[model samples]
Target: MQRKSWKKPALIVAVLVAVAMVTSFCRSRETAPAHGNGAPAAVPIRVAAAHRGDLDLTLKVIGRAEAYSTVNVQARVSGQLQELLFKPGGHVKQGDTIIRIDPSLLQAQLDQALGNLAKDEAQLVNAQAVLKRYSLLIGKGYVSQSDYDTYKANEGLYLASVKADKAAVELARTELSYAQIQAPFDGIAGAPLVYPGAQVTANDTSIVVLNQIHPIHITFSIPETGLAGTQASMARGTVPVTATLPGTKLPPMQAELDFINNAVDITTSTIQLKARYDNHDDHLTPGQFVEVVLPTTRLTNVVTVPVVALQNSPLGSFVFVVNADDTVQQRMVSAGPSSNGQIVIEKGLSGDERVVTDGQLLLVDGARVRIVTGNG
Candidate 1:
């Protein structure tokens, strides 16, 4: 009876062990990755075709708007400020009078100069007539030799005096012209520094300020490393430039790269650049900060992909390249500047492969993918 009871306990223990093992096995299978047991499931991904085309390698930097020209209307001749011809902050065209000095004194000086010139002319004519008469009398022995010599000397002296008087007249006229101050270019004029009835000296006092607003210039700097590329682009053709004014609804201003500084800034390690724009609408102003965009160069027949296709990894930035069998391979690519949602692939692309644009999170190396028409 004891042996039979021991055998029954043993059979019960065996059955319980078998049930535990089966339960553990089922749990293990449930927890295992789906790809581990069989072929990986296809991950739905959006893709873009890499193409060979032109890529504009562009750069953006902060720039400042500058007037094409700035002028300080200073007195060129000393005088009393007689009239302020232009209102404060008035728009002026080239040669438009902005200020007028008291010309009464200058006019009187001119008149005096004219009178002196006339007097010299009359004296010169009298000296010539006397010299002629002396020459005739000397030939006929009617006048003393000393008297004839005196008249010749007087004629020569008067001739020089007339030339001097003519020069004085021109000088007086030039001094008179300085009485009126005109705008040097099309610009906006600031208030007169020397008001009417105030005394100002030649080039010693500022009468007004003028700034050219239309056809303005934008100044910016880029790193020295980009100098070579910028110069090469300029040599090839007109480098395209654009400026965006902040806090304004105006469209971006388009311009051409006009000036590149000959020397780089040693302290900043940057090279300065200037662009010319036609600001006929007066949308841009002097000293205003703006954002500048420039296309430095174009790469022809280069492989390019959408910017979204670029993926960052622990190693580096890469993109998933789709093979013929719909298997995705991670391609480490060197990227250049991006423009309009497209990025230049400098390396590791042949311009014919498909690149994954979305659903990259579900992908791994050599993962099979299903290309979806829409972004996934």
Candidate 2:
């Protein structure tokens, strides 16, 4: 009985102490600040002023450089290759001789055709003179009508032979001219397939490959969604394009939009486009991969800001606009297309406001901000 009584008294004391502790905690909670310190510390951030400027709608795509023109030089006439006029990888101009076949045989054939032509011409002249005299005698009874007709027929035969011989001469001359293979255009020539002393067949032998590189073409594709915009830009006049080499620090190559395929590629859902670059500096090479930036639209005189300034929440896309008092006001924005590190703001925030580009995570409406960059 004594032990049980002592237990009850100790238990009562413990209950009272617990109630006092609970009361003290409630009081401390009531007295404490609701959010952080009573004096809110200023949030550090970087900002950029919204300004009226121009921004281009562009997309970067991988493009492949190609020769403006490529041709496989072939022999038109059969002969033993006498000389390779150009070294492997040599540059040749239009009509420059790149290969030479043994011309002695062709020369002899031309001479033979010339001789046949001369013989036919002489015979035609003699027959024509005899036919003229016979015609005069036929009228005066010095020659019979049948005899005159025979002379006239002989003259026609010689004339026909001369015409045939002339055609033969032209053909022979054409064949002889083919002995020296000429470059079709200004280009770089590949290694000759047929060396000197090698027999080459007409139209069956490839002498070299020529690739025109001065004005290079870059072929690439863009998403079909951009096709309409690209077409619109093209309709406004020449659309500008820029090509950059992947691993070089050189400035980008400026080019013009040259061709857009009539139809979209069903397999890839992309529209093929080609850009022409005057690669006069030899900066671009055929078969090289490059990054091509094509501007689809040009938005001018619009309020724009850095893309990072735009933020999103459950509500919508918004930005923290800093006031002259260095306080932030959350404003919902209708964000348009973004490009070149900037985005166009179609609504909210005029061109005179400053926006927080960084440290936006700690920002809220009516929150104090410290402008660490841009206008203080």
Candidate 3:
């Protein structure tokens, strides 16, 4: 009985050991990192190739559309604002009669001046005839010399009066013409400050503002850093510019660089530029905000990459370039001006390498990669 008991205990111990070993083996298998063919796991990522192409660098800035010219249409003569021949915000042509003042008062003054001139001319003619008679009588001794001299002096006085009267008539005519106000150019007339029957003073009252919308001038500013490039492009020819309104389907309006400020603004560190566009359809209005795109410079046959591929770190800007062996290596690049969606790689790229654009979080330097989409 003792031998049988000892053998039974030994068997139990053996079975327990076997069971513990199996449990430990299973736990080890569960805890180990799984891999196929004992290879490291690959990171899933998308990539775009660093391409070689001519990059036309451009700069986009906010601009304001302004009238080519603006003028304040004021009353030239002081009188009652009798008629406003233009509608508020209406278009007017050059020399179009825009305002008609009450001409009755002006006309009366003109008539009075004209009557005075006629009377003076008639008196002048009579004085000349009397002077001629006096001359003939003096020669014949029928009139005293003093009487002749007096008549001659009177004739000169009448002649001076006639000359003065003629000048008055011209002045009256000019004053009469001022009763009608004309437009100086083809433009949009703003609100009339003075209504009809309201007395307005010449050159003092704010009557209406006229703005020439066609051939609109667009004013924009750029950082002083871009001044050299802009001037270089201008030296070759007029630098081209285009304006567009956001949230609209209209095509970009073409313009040319027409003016550049002589000095940079000290406070803002920017330079102002003006572009002109022939807005024949009158689409662009003064004071309307717009987006202006201007070509700043051009890079020839340079290595470029999507902006997304370029990454920033504490050190500087860099990108992940995929090697021939399907591995990625972080490449330090000298980045230049960015245009559209691409940035010029001024250094560290040979213009044909594939750069990792996505799945960057799953990547490290010298990590193996599978080109999922044949990034090129």
Candidate 4:
């Protein structure tokens, strides 16, 4: 009986030990690391090949639209406003009649001046006849020399009077012409500041404002560093410019760079530039703000990469280039002017390497990579 009981207890202990061993073994298998063949997983990335191409260095800036010419039409003669030739906010051509002042008083003054001139001329003619007679009498001793001399002096004074009266008539005519105001250029006229029948004084009353919309001017500024390139390009030919209005569906306005400021602005550290556009459609208006795209220079046969591939570090900018072994190597790079979503690789690139564009944050020097796209 004692042998049988010991055998039963040994069997129970054996079963418990076996059960524990099986559970531990299963747990070990569940916790074991798996990385697609027991190696660290390669990071999947998108890349682009650095290639030689022409890159245009375009500078975009905020610019303001301005009228090519602006003028404040002012009254040039004192008179009552009789009629306005143009309606408020109307278009006018150069030399178009814009305003008409009351001409009744001006005409009367002109007539009186003309009468005075005619009267002086008649007296001058009479004086000449008398002077001729006096000369003949003085030579023949028919009249005293002092009397003949008086007649000659009187004749000269009458001639002087005739010239003065003629000048007065011309002055009256000029004054009359001022009563009619004409537009100085082709432009859009603003609201009349003075109404009809109101007495307006010369140079003291604001009549209307004229703004030339066609071939408008746009003014913007650029950094001083770009000044040399802009001037160089301008010297070759017309530097092209493009301007767009924010939040508008209108097409960009084409312009030509025309004016460069002689001096740089000290406070802003930027040089001002002006471009002219043929705004025949009247799309651009005076005092409107716009976006200006200025092309500073064009580079040829330059190595370029997407700007996203560049990584910054304590040392400097860098990029990860893929090698034949499907591994990435970190290369220090010198970056130059960036435009149109690409950055110019100034150094440390040979224009034939595949640079990682996406998934860069997951990479390290000499890291293994699986190119998901752009692999040849």
| Most accurate candidate by TM-score | 2
Model 2: lDDT to the true structure: 0.89
Model 2 C-alpha lDDT per residue in residues 7-83, reported as the tens digit of each score: 88899999999999999999987786443466466788998889888777999999999999999888899999998
Cα lDDT of model 4 by residue, 1-376, tens digit: 8768789889999999999999999997778745567656688999999988988799999999988999998888889999999977778999989999999999999999999999989988998999898888788889998998888898899999999998999999999998999998888898889899899998988888999877799999999989998998898898999999999999888899999999999998999999999888888888999999998987999999999999999999999999998899999999998997999999999899999999999999998888995453
- Give me candidate 1's TM-score against the actual structure: 0.80
Give the backbone clash total of model 3.
0
Q: If both were scored by lDDT, which would come out higher, candidate 1 or candidate 3? A: 1
Q: What are the clashing pairs of model 3?
A: none
Against the reference, the lDDT scores of all candidates come to 0.89, 0.89, 0.88, 0.91
TM-score, each model?
Answer: 0.80, 0.82, 0.70, 0.74
Give the per-residue Cα lDDT of candidate 1 at 314.
88
Assess the local accuracy of residue 99 in candidate 3 as a C-alpha lDDT between 0 and 100.
89
Estimate the Cα RMSD of every predicted model relative to the unseen true structure.
6.3, 6.1, 6.9, 7.0
Count of backbone collisions in candidate 2: 0
- Compose the digit string of candidate 1's lDDT tens values, residues 318-344: 999998998999999898878869988
Report lDDT (Cα) of residue 277, candidate 3.
93
Model 3: lDDT to the true structure: 0.88
Worst 10 residues of 1 by lDDT: 32-41
lDDT for each residue of candidate 3 in 1-376, tens digit (9 for 90 to 100) = 7658789889999999999999999998777654467556677678887889887778899999999999987777889989999989889999999989888888898899889989988988898899998898899889999999888888898889889888888987898899898998888999988899899888888788999887889999999998988888898897889999888899998999999999999999999999999899787899999999998887789988999999988889899998898889998888987898999999999988889988888888988887776544
Q: For model 4, give the 10-residue run with minimal summed lDDT.
A: 32-41
